[model samples]
Structure formats: C-alpha cells, structure tokens
Target chain A: MFRERLAQDAARIQKQFDLVLGALSDVDVTQAMSYATQGGKRLRGFLVLESARMHQVDIDRAIWPATGIEALHAYSLVHDDLPCMDDDDLRRGRPTVHMKWDEGTAVLAGDALHTLAFELCTRPEVGTADIRADLALTLAQASGAQGMVLGQALDIAAETAASPLTLSEITRLQAGKTGALIEWSAGAGARLAQADPAPLRQYAQALGLAFQIADDILDVEGDAEKAGKRLQKDARAGKATFVSLLGLDAAKARASELVDEACAALTGYGASAETLKDAARFVISRDS
Target chain B: MFRERLAQDAARIQKQFDLVLGALSDVDVTQAMSYATQGGKRLRGFLVLESARMHQVDIDRAIWPATGIEALHAYSLVHDDLPCMDDDDLRRGRPTVHMKWDEGTAVLAGDALHTLAFELCTRPEVGTADIRADLALTLAQASGAQGMVLGQALDIAAETAASPLTLSEITRLQAGKTGALIEWSAGAGARLAQADPAPLRQYAQALGLAFQIADDILDVEGDAEKAGKRLQKDARAGKATFVSLLGLDAAKARASELVDEACAALTGYGASAETLKDAARFVISRDS
Candidate 1:
C-alpha cells in the first residue's frame, strides 16, 4: 500500500513538473531543465504528500512543496554530476546534463530548477502568504550555503585532505548533505498545517540517517543497473562510509536500529502513520 | 550627488552581506560565496533602495530585497564566468572564483548565493508576509528560466548559430538577460507598498535597454583598467552587438534617447525622482 501511494504521488508530481516547465519558453535550457528533473525516486515528494495527508492538508496545496522539493533535489543532482564536481556521465540511467547538452546548459538548467523550487513554494495556492514565506525561507535555509552546499563543500575538501574523515565527521557531512532536505520534507506537512513539527522532525532525523546508511550499504552490495547509475565509487575513492567505518554487518545492524527509532517517533500519529513507518522500513531494505 | 548616494547604498548593502553570510559556519563554500559577491557596481541594489525610499519603505525593511538582488546578480556573474561558459579569469579586477578555488567550490558557491537571494527576500523584516512572498515569487520569475537564464541560454545558442543575431533578436535576448531583473528591482518598492508598479516598471524598461547599450559601447571603446574586464571580445568573436549592429555614433545617440525616455517615465514622481533621473543619465555616461 505504501509503495502504491509513493508511485501515485511520484506520477502526480511528474505532472506538476510538466505544468510548470511547459509554461517556460522552448529554449534549450528549458528543455535541459525538463530532462534533468525527470526520473528521480521521488521519495522526498512522497514524504511530503504522506505527511500532508496525515495533517489533512489538501493534496492540491500539498503538491506545491512536494514538487518544489523534487525540483530542488533534481537541481542538486544535475550540478553534482557536472564535470567539475562528481564528473559522472550517467544519472538515472541516462547521460548527465553536461554530457547530453553541455556544461553551460547544465549549469543554467540547474540554476533554473533551483529558482523554480522557490517559485513553487510561493504559489498562491500553497497556503496563506505567511505560510508561503515560511516555506521559501526554510527551503532556502535547507538548500543553501549553510545546508546542502556546506555538506557538498566538505565532501570535496575531504577528497583532498591528508587523511580520511572520522565517523563523526562523516555523520556531520551527511546531516547537512542529505539529512536536511529529508527533515524539511517530513516537517512540511506540519508547516502547512501550522502544527508543531517535533514528532516529524524526530522521525525524519532517524529516517535520514538510516537512509544514508542504506545508501552506503547499497554502494557496497547493490547492482548498478538496478540503482541506475555507477556504484562502488565511494569504495573506489577510498572514502569512509557507514559500511566502511562500521563494517557491512554492523552498518546494516545500525540502519535497522535507526528504522526502529523512526517508527517510534511516529507513535503519536497512531495507526495513520503506518505508511511512514513502512517508508522507514523500506529505506533500509530497498534494493535500489 | 547621485553617485554619492549610489555608493552609500552600495556600502550599506555590503554590510548586509556581512551580517547574513557571517552567521553561517566558516566553510569554504561560504568563503567562496563572499568572494563571488564582492566588488560589483551594485546598481540593481541601488534601484531597490532608491525606489523603496520613494515609496516610504524603511531602510531596515528595504535592505533585504536590496541585498537579495545583488546576490542574484553575483550568482549570475559567477556562473557566467565558468570555464564552460564565458571562461573569464578576471572579474572586478580580481581572480574569478574558479581561478581562486576550484570549479566545484565555484559551482557550490554560486548555487548557495542563488539560494541566499531568496532567503533575503523572505526575511521577516522585509514587510508583511504577503509582501515577502510576492517579492520572492517575482524574483524567481525574473531570475529563472523565463528571465535571466533564458537570456543566457539564447546567448549561448547565438554563439554557434550560422548567422549573427539580428538587431531584434539581440534586443529580445537582452530583455531576458539584463532587463528582467532591472524591472523587478525598480518595481519592488511598489510591490512593498502594494501600489501600482507601472511607472517604475516603465522607467526600468527604458533604463535597462539603455544600460545594455552603454555596456556595448564600453566594450568597444572603454579602457580595460576602468571597466576592469576584457574589451572588444564581441567584435573579435564576430558577435553582433549594439555598436556593431548600429554604427557607434548611432548607438550612442540611441542610448542617450533611451535615457531621456527612462527619465521621462519618472514624471509621475515629480521632483522626488531626480536621483533616479540622474542614475539613468549616468548609465550611458559612465565608463563602467
């Protein structure tokens, strides 16, 4: 049931992307923007819709932040795959934006997608103006220098440092890189409803950590074809990851524990939170 | 006197940059962000501050959007100067971000600054929540795929086209590339006050075109030391510019005429708009 809902939400958000990007001129950059935003897992968007459903926020209103987070995520990936960054040629089973169009298009497309995230959050249908402002402000905070970019910068610096990062250092990096957006997505429902987000925040904190651990484990064990991109790059780079730091068995054990804590964080929501609990479980178990 | 006010506003906005970026952790990305944002004309920011003053918006409130536009402009320049783009090595008489650091740092810094622009627009002191939301929304429109990015994409396409861009084509490109943000900056005060933005919008339209024409003239004739960048690259590349499309004398005359139109648009504000008229005149007269 949770998987079905996740798939449904992903399709809906895909339509949202069409609506927004279609309104732009038919320039190559816009076309590149469309291409880059396609084929994400859409887990973040799912978290948004499920949380909004938990709060009784209308789907029509929920879709804005749902699509916004996806766009933001897409923008990050496009730039991350740039020749100057991760230098990856493949993303989501296709050529990266730079490989397909060129770096200038890739950069501009990513930049446009970033702005579109704010645009979606500020839409009139999203909520009251206060809510819209809060959403955009928090989104910026989660994605900017102090958040995802900070994490990425640290990662790059780590690549050239004299020594590998410690476990704690890796944890701090992941918190900024991947954890911030996950927490924000989990809490968006409460933000939309103007409700206290402590429980969702707690839930997301565990979920995000578990998610990263799973990613580390997948890097070691998962199939690249199924994952739809290059795998084992972390090990190849000799970078420390959850699996490397804790050993594969210990990393798996830790991820399972984090999932339990995540499920516990949703106890206040009662049975209706079952889908989110399933999501936490799936985070650790998914082949991809 | 107008130049003095412009410089004063620039200094004030620079301080705002320090206050905001200083609060972030001293990461390399933040350092690169500070580097990218430093040393610009700050004309867009001045337009915001001056128009806000005309609308009785307090400096405390007005400074948010003022800094926001500059940050946006800075991000555009940083990305535009990338090795894959314009490949500029010097900006504002100093090494470009990529030259100072690496391409990864430069890309992350530019992305962070882009987000910072929205963050500034959504600040609590900016005004009522409605106004803040409107500012962010309009800013995304002006700077995103349909605006500045569109202009940039078109410019890149022109570089490889079989024929040089015609006069009408270059004009359309400039509208998105440079004119959109200028119009947004000028209209921001009216947006803050919930007043009609038509007059300021009119003023900005003429002023923005004149500003680009002046830039073309500078590219052809200005001293590199004063302009602080390369000159005649357009002619060397055989790219058609305002000066190349129109004779140099005709281009100068057209810029002067547009300055008159820009100044005329402020007649609704009467004597209180003298500084803005001076700014329009300075657009064509200054070397940079």
Candidate 2:
C-alpha cells in the first residue's frame, strides 16, 4: 500500500512539474529545467504529500509545496552535478543537465528552478498568505548558507582537508546537506495545517540520517546500474561516510535503529502514520 | 542630493548584507558571498528604498526588500561571471568570485545569496504576511525563467547564433535581463504600501532601458579603470548592442529621451519625485 501510494505521489509531482514548466517558453534553459526535474524518486514530495494527508490539508493546497520542494531538490541536483562540483556525467541513468546542455544553460535552469520553488510556495491556492510566506521563509533557511549550501561547502572543504572528517563532523555535514530538506518536507504538513510539527520533525531527523547511512551502505554494496549513477565514489575519494566511520555491519545496525526511532516518533498519529513509518523502513531497504 | 541619498542607501544595504551573512559560519561559500555582494552601484536597492520613501514606508520595514533586491542582483552577477558563462575575471575592480575562490565555492555562494534574497523579503519587518508573500512572489517571477533567466539564456544562445540579434530582439532580451528587476525594485514601495504601482512601473521601464543604453555607451567611451571592469568587449565579440544597432550618437540621444520619459512618468508625485527624476538623469549621465 505504501509503495503504491509513493508511486502515485511521484506521478502527481511529475505532473505538477509539467504543468509549471509547460507554462515557460520552449527555450534550452526551460527545457533543461523540465528534463532535470524528471525521474527523481520524489521522496521529498512524497513526504510532503503524505504528511499533508495525515494533517488533512487539501491535496490542492499540498501539491504546491510538494512541487516546490521537488523543484528545489532538482535545482540542487543540477547545480551539484556541474563540472565544478560533483562533475558527474550521469544522474538517474541520464545525462546531467550540464552534460546535456552547456554549463550556462544548466546554471540558469537551476536558478530558475530555485525561484520556481518559492513561486510555487507563494501561489494563492496554497493557502492564506501567511502560510505561503512561512513556507517560503522556512525553505530559504533550509536551502541557504545556513543549511544545504553550508553542508555542501563543508563537503567540498572536507575533500581537501588534511585528514578525513570525524564522525561528528560528517554527521553535521549530512544534517545540513540532506537532513535539512527532509526535515522541512516532513514538517510541511504541520506548517500548512498550522499545527505543531515536533513529532514529524523528530521522525524526519531519524529518517534523514538513516537515509544517508543507507546511501553509504548502497555505495558499498548496491549495484551501479540499480543506483543509476556512479557508486563508491566516496570510498575512492577517501571521504568519510557513515560506513567508513562505523563498520559496515555497525552502520546497518545504526540505520535500523534510526528506523525504529523514526517509527516511534510517529506514534502520536498512530496507524494514520503507518505509511510514513514504512517510508522510514524503506529508506534503509531500498536498493537504489 | 540624489547622489547622497543613493550613497546612503548603498551603505545601508551593505550593512544589512553584513548582518545577514555574518550569522553564517566562516566557510568559503559564505565568505565568497560576502565578497561578491561587497560592491556594486546598488541602483536597484536605491530604487527600492527611494520608492519606499516616496510611499512613506518606514526605513526599518523598507530595508528588507531593498537588501533583497541587491542580494538577487549580486547572485545574478556571480553566476554571470562564471567560467562557463561570461568568463570575466574582474568585477568592481577585484577578482570575480570564481577567480577569488574555486568554481564550486562561487556556485554555492551565488545559490546562497539567491536564497538570501527571498529570506530578506519574507522577514517580519518587511510587512504583513500578505505583503511579504507578495514581495517574494513578484521577486521570484521577476528573477525566474519568465524574466531575468530567460534574458540571460537568450543572451547565451545569441553568442553562437549565425547572426546577431536585431534591434527588436535585443530590446526584448534586455527587457527580461535588466528591466524586470528594475521594475520590481521601483514598484516595491507601492507594493509594500498597497498602493498603485503603475506610475512607478512606467517610470522604471524608461529608466531601465535608458540605463542599458548608457551602459552600452560607456562600454564604448568610458575608461576601464573608472568602469571597474573590462569594457568594449561587446564590440570586440561582435555582439549586438545598443551602440552597435543605433550608433553612438543615436543611442545617447535615445537614452536621454528615455530619461525624459522616466521623469515625466513621475509627475503624478509632483515635487516629491524630484530625487527620482534626478536618478533618471543620473542613469544616463553617470561616468560609472
């Protein structure tokens, strides 16, 4: 049931992206934005929709922020895949934005997508103006220098540091890099509902960390074809990862523990949050 | 008086940037963001503040969107200066962000500043929730694919085209590239005050076109040292510009005419708009 719901949510998010980008001129940058936003797992959007479902927010309202988060995520991926950053040629089994087009198109497309995120958030259909402002504000915080960008800068700095980052440093980096967005996604429903987000935030904190650990484990054991991109690059680069810090078995164990904690955090919502708990478990078990 | 007001507003915007970026970790991206935002004409911010003053908005409330526009402008400049983009090495008489730091740092810094723009717009001090959302929504529209990004992409595509852009085509391109943000800045005060923005919008349309024409004229006639960056590159690259399309004499005459139109648009405000008229005159007359 959860897998089916996730698939449905992903399709919905893709449709939202189509609706948004289709309004743009058929230029290279707009086309690149449409291309880059396609084929993601849409986990962030799912978290938003599912959490919104639990909060009983209208799908009409929820979809805006769901699409917004996905757009922001796509922007980050497009920029991260640039030659100056990760330098990856493939993403989701296709050419990266900068590889498919020129770097200038990629940069502009990413930037447009970044603005699209806030644009979607502020759409009147999303809710009262206050809700829209709150969403845009929190998103800026999650994605800006204090959050995702800071994490990325730290990651780049770590690559050239004299020694491998300590486990705590790696955790901090991952929190900013990935955890911030995930937490924001999870908390969106409550923000939209104007309810307390403590439980959802707690759930996402564990789930995001577990997600990263699972990613590290996948780099070690998952098939390159299944992941649809390069694998084990961290190990090759001598970058510290969860698996690098803890033994592989211990890392797996920790991820499982995090999943358990994630599930526990959803106790307040009881069976209504079962799918979200399943999402937590799936984070560690998914091959991709 | 207009020059002094512009200088005062520029310093205020700079201080706001310092306060915002100062809260972040002393990382390369944050430092690069500071450097990139350090110097500029601050014309957009000045427009925001000056228009806000005309509308009787308080400085504390007005400063947010003023700073927001400047941050957005800085983001555009940083990205435009990248090796993959315009490839210029000097800006404001200093090394470009990418030249000062690595490309990754520059990219991240630009991205952070882009987010910071929205963050500033959504601040509580900016206005009520609806007004803040309005500012962010309009900003996203002005800076996104339909506006600034579209202009930039067209400019990039024009580089490799078999023929240079025609007068009408370049006019449309500049409307998106530079005119959108200028219009937004000029209208911000009216938006913040919930007043009609039509007059300010008209004023800015003329002002922005005049500003671009002046830039083209300066590129041909001004000193590189005074311009604080490379000049005459448009002519060298065989790129179509106002001066190329209209000739130096015609371009200057057109700019002067636009400044007159700009000042005429401000007649609704009577003597209160004298400074804005001076601004329009300064747009065409300034050395840099």
| Candidate with best lDDT | 2
Error of 2 at B287 (Å): 1.2
Per-residue CA lDDT of model 1 for A122-180, tens digit only, reads 99999999999999999999998878888898899899989999999999999989999
Q: Write the per-residue lDDT of candidate 2 for residues A80-192, one digit (tens) a residue.
A: 99999999999999999988988988999999999999999999999999899999999999999999999999999999999999999999999999999999999999999
Per-candidate Cα lDDT values, in order, are: 0.93, 0.94
C-alpha lDDT (0 to 100) for residue A169 of candidate 2: 98
Residues B1-288 of candidate 1 have per-residue lDDT tens digits of 689999999999999999998999897889988888888899999999999999998989999999999999999999999999999998998899999998888899999999999999998999999999999999999999989999999999999999999999999999999999999999998898988889999999999999999999999999988888888889999998999999899999999999999999999898889999999999999987
What value does the lDDT take at residue A56 in candidate 1? 98
Mind giving the per-residue lDDT tens digits that candidate 2 earns over B1-288? 899999999999999988988999999999999999988889999999999999999989999999999989999999999999999999999999999998989899999999999999998889999999999999999999999999998999899999999999999899999999999999999999999989999999999999999999999999999999999999999999999999999999999999999999999899889999999998898897
TM for every model, in the order presented, reads: 0.99, 0.99
Which 10 successive residues of model 2 chain A have the least lDDT summed?
A97-106
The interface root-mean-square deviations, each candidate in sequence, come to: 0.7, 0.5
